[model samples]
Target: MTFQAGGSFDIDAWDADKPYDERDGTKLTRVSVRKTFHGDLVGTSTTELITVESSAGPVAYVGIEHVQGILHGREGTFVLQHSAGSEDGTPGTQWLRWLIVPTSGTGELAGIRGVGQITVTEDGAHTWTLEYSLD
Candidate 1:
């Protein structure tokens, strides 16, 4: 059966650094993220976000997040892969999407498969909805 987990998260820490200049005023930046989640899913996640930036704006980014926590009382861990892009920073133009890595689930969540979506409001309120099923 499929289940839904809804929750909010707070960015506990974000460490970013520019390691090199690719060219044309574009730089390669690496960021480490630590977040704490609340509500239906409870625990913390550590993620690495790599962003490609130019003089205009951020061209693209890819992130891999390891989520460790309890979902609806099941204790386990999983991974989420994030990919997104946007240069103009226009509303409805920039997109961020995350998906579960196949067979990455462990513990009680072994064999879990699903997709998740995240939304961040202007006030920095982050929310997530995960639709998933467990084997």
Candidate 2:
């Protein structure tokens, strides 16, 4: 099934982290993602690349890396550490977020234990979404 959704995110490195100005220029972002799933048990994960363009500026592409755990009963969870920096994308803008989600074991996951530095965006707002993808 093909899907389309709109969302936003908030990034706060830390109350007292390095690069103070970076902490201030910090802005919330909204994005939309679409993917196609291939049917297969013990399905393989396809790489997802995202780039966001807001009315305020240029396109900001996200460079993400994920390490997923094993699948249990056609469902599994993956822990991902995403950093928003790439010489091939936006410059002077960086971010980091962690994600945990239920695996369709095929495509994009929903009903997530969305934590770390990431949140789901909807109707131009952001919120944490979690449902525990594993036991």
Candidate 3:
């Protein structure tokens, strides 16, 4: 059966490298981030991302996040594949998505699979929604 989870998370840390590649007006960099979740899903996660930026602002990013803790009451771990982008570097034009890595669930989370999305509020708060199922 499918379950829905929703929550907000706080960014605990963010470490980014100087642009490793720059050309014209675009640049690429690597970033590592840590977050703590609250609400229906309670956990901590570490993410590694590759980002693209332009004069307008952030253009896109792809990442992998490993999360550990509890979802509802099920305790375990899972990995999320992220793909986010903006056509105009504006919130109205951006999309932040996550795909639960197949077979990456451990412990009580085994066989979990689904997709999720993240929303960044204008004031910079981050919230998420997930739809998933476990075998």
Cα-based lDDT for every prediction: 0.87, 0.34, 0.96
Model 2, global lDDT: 0.34
| Strongest candidate by TM-score | 3
TM-score of 2: 0.24
Expressed as tens digits, the lDDT of each residue in 2-95 for candidate 3 is: 9999989999999999999999999999999999999888999999999999998999999999999999899999999999999989999989
What is the model-wide C-alpha lDDT for candidate 3? 0.96
Worst 10 residues of 2 by lDDT: 12-21
How well is each residue in 1-135 modelled by candidate 1, as lDDT tens digits? 999889899999999986555877777889999999998899999999998887767767899999999999999999999987775654346677789999999999889899887776777688888899998
The runs of at least 3 residues in candidate 3 whose Cα sits more than 4 Å from the true structure, single-residue gaps closed, are none
Q: Is candidate 1 or candidate 3 better by lDDT?
A: 3
TM-score of each: 0.89, 0.24, 0.98
Q: Among all windows of ten consecutive residues in candidate 1, which has the lowest summed lDDT?
A: 86-95
RMSD in order of candidates: 1.6, 12.9, 0.6
Ranking by TM-score: 3, 1, 2
